[model samples]
Target chain A: LKALNGDRRRWDIAKLIYMNNISPNDCIKRWKGEDVDEDHESEIEEEEEDFFQKRNGTASNEKDAHEGDLETFKPYFETLDRLMQKWKKTDLLKDRFIGKPAFSNEDDA
Target chain B: MAPLVFQGSENFRLRLILATLAGKPIRIENIRSNALDPGLKDYHVSFLRLLEAVTNGSKMEISYTGTTVIYTPGIIIGGSHSHKCPNSKPVGYFVEPLLYLAPFSKKKFSIVFKGITASHNDAGIEAIKWGMMPIMEKFGVRECALHTLKRGSPPNGGGEVHLIVDTLLAQPITIHELERPKIMAIKGVSYSTRVSPSMVNRTIDGARKVLRNIGCEVDITADVWRGENSGNSPGWGITLVSQGQRGWCTFSEVIGDAGEVPEEIGMKAAYSLLEEISNSAVLGRPQLPLAIVFMVIGKEDIGRLRISRAQIDERFIQLLRDIKTVFGIEAFLKDVDDPDSDDFIVTIKGVGFTNTSKKIA
Candidate 1:
């Protein structure tokens, strides 16, 4: 458990921990015995976004081990939501209005 | 009849999953066709063998180059079966996908998955036990159990997991839950194999230190394996699963590395669990794919689900797109009414695909 010069070793070599998900980005500040506040938590959120950044240029989305990335997805998801609402409500309603009515206008009937 | 054709090795598992569930044949081309070691990997081969064992007459044809595959799915005739999982991937890799097929099997699904229990790339057994189970229960799965019979580490893998699902759902219920429930309890598993038992205590202490601030009750169990049950390697790890009142559950775990101390593993898992709890949706990130499947296959009525915006990563998007292609079902995504929360409500209409192979009661 001792590091060089009789100092206590930190997290194995500490390098592997940094390389993995235990980085401060995943909220390790709390584990480090550091004071954590809302501001620090918000900062961690931004770092996490960077951690899950977009890699859309490479490989098919369905490929093994290549789940979708983090950045860019929020915007893409927003656009999709808007388009779905437009098509499901506006276009479908318009298409139905254009087609023959289930019952002709009551007065005409 | 022409079979569904797909390109590349993407969604390899999903394609197989959909094909089996839909009783349709699928042909996949150009799997890792451009890579240096272009072709199906060892895990892929082992997974395919496991699939065949779990079902009846699932035929698979691989080209001499291993870049193309044609799989004719068979009915799930699940029963007692055992397979040796490749060390390249953990048991969770094979078992996660298999659970999707279990509820539709002819008999109660019973399988023994022997391999490295924990790995960097896959969910550990504890996640499936505490986290995945509750999610399945929300969709009307009656009784299922995941037992970690042995602990194994990578390279010299020799772990075993016995999974049993005694009940089947005629059809998964339509779940339209939107509220982000409150977490009431956090249960955890800290384990060691062929290592000093002190490692487990150290891990629990480190985890408890971080979790002490939370208002909920935190209980972490320490598991130790003896003799042959310890598997072939020495390692330690921790998996923390959180439970909310309304069937919302999630898990985070960390496996000890070659030089990593037990305390670090505990702290890592605790921190990750905090990250997961921050996205307090009805399902955890790992549970999203499973929810998608049953939501699409359940009753024809629309099922609405709420998920944090953080969970809207590429894999989730691609899975939705794939469902649109294969099942011809689209999910209606929209912002939740609560402006304070960054959650999206996904509304999907299930296809009402019931298990035809199941025997009549």
Candidate 2:
């Protein structure tokens, strides 16, 4: 716990706490010393920068980094949504276009 | 068969594996086109070589700058072979696709792979052993084995693993329903090579601290390798698998770093396993690609699966497009309506592909 508290500035440690069931309030109380508001906020700010840089490879600021990450994945989400819409439309049209033959050649023969 | 063309180097493994299975040629262009050091890397070349080793009559053409490659796939003639993987990537990167292709090979496939066994990026060998093999069995392919002969770490790798699989011509599988199985126990392997033997114990102790409250029996074994079994590098890592009923297992792992403590690795791995278990998905993250492959090529009927959105990435979307283009199998994904639900139900009907030619049957 001491080690984690000492290295609480690291982004991975923050991630670890976030992933586990520990609440942010408890984490702040245990890891960050009381009455050190500036230090605690700075540490979180630095961790956010590190997280964004690691996530999308470019991070000028936290907001820009987050937007960039979203931009990187926006095309994929759009493509998936478009594909799903097309498939749904195709399913609606399948019965009319792909129904059984009205007159079988064997019956005609 | 007409050649399938695509841009970019993403989904390279999936494209090649599907091409081999479909008996079609593929032309990939603009590989890393915008990157500073664009084109195929040494690791990509090594993967291509491994593919060539498993197939017969395969032909490849590469541009001088390595920006373009045209691959004509050949018959999958599976037999004993070996390849040295590049140090840049872990063996898991290559092993995952091999798991998809091995069962359909013409002969009983046995391959010895040498490279990094565990790393931060790719799925570790232990994950595949516990998580993927059982899923493959559900698809009716049996007698698959992955054995670690030497433990290796990243940067300078010398690990060795032996893989064996029995081929099947055509096997139809039906999995209409997936029930969330109750986790019976949690098992793990904490290993170190050329490192302090106490590292294993530290990892196990740290993992147990987090895992004991999960209401399941937990057992983690430790192994310290030396001499021939230990690779050149000095490193340690932990692989944790949560075993559930109905052949369901979730895997998580963490590789040690220069300044990281064993306890951190163990705790991180345990938390990752817990996250996976809590995520309401039928297929584990690593098993998502394999399940999609089976759904595309299995018997012609509706196949349904509910997977977490975390498993759906750009590579998975590209794979769906490729399957649609090559095999004419359409896949649909619909998000569940629950506000707290993170599941996407995917449905697809297979193309009923069957292999008619067998070298020995």
Clash totals for all models, in order? Answer: 5, 0
What's the TM-score of chain A alone for every prediction? 0.19, 0.17
lDDT of candidate 1 over B281-346, digit per residue (tens): 776778888898989989889999988766765456556756766787777766677645556688
**B1-361 per-residue lDDT for model 2 (tens digits):** 6678977776787888888888889999998888899999898899899999999999988999999999999988879998899998888888878988887777878999999988876768787888788888878777898999998887787999998887465644856543445667788999998888999899899888766545457889998898888888999999888776666677777789888889867877776666555543665656777888987888888888777655654345545667766676667766555545555668878877675446443
Candidate 2 Cα outliers beyond 4 Å, as residue runs = A1-109, B167-169, B334-342, B359-361
The TM-score of predicted model 1 comes to 0.77
Error of 2 at A3 (Å): 47
- Worst lDDT run of 10 residues, candidate 2 chain B, spans B309-318
TM per model? Answer: 0.77, 0.75
**Best model per TM-score:** 1
Global Cα RMSD, each model: 18.2, 17.4
How good is the docking of model 2, by CAPRI class? incorrect
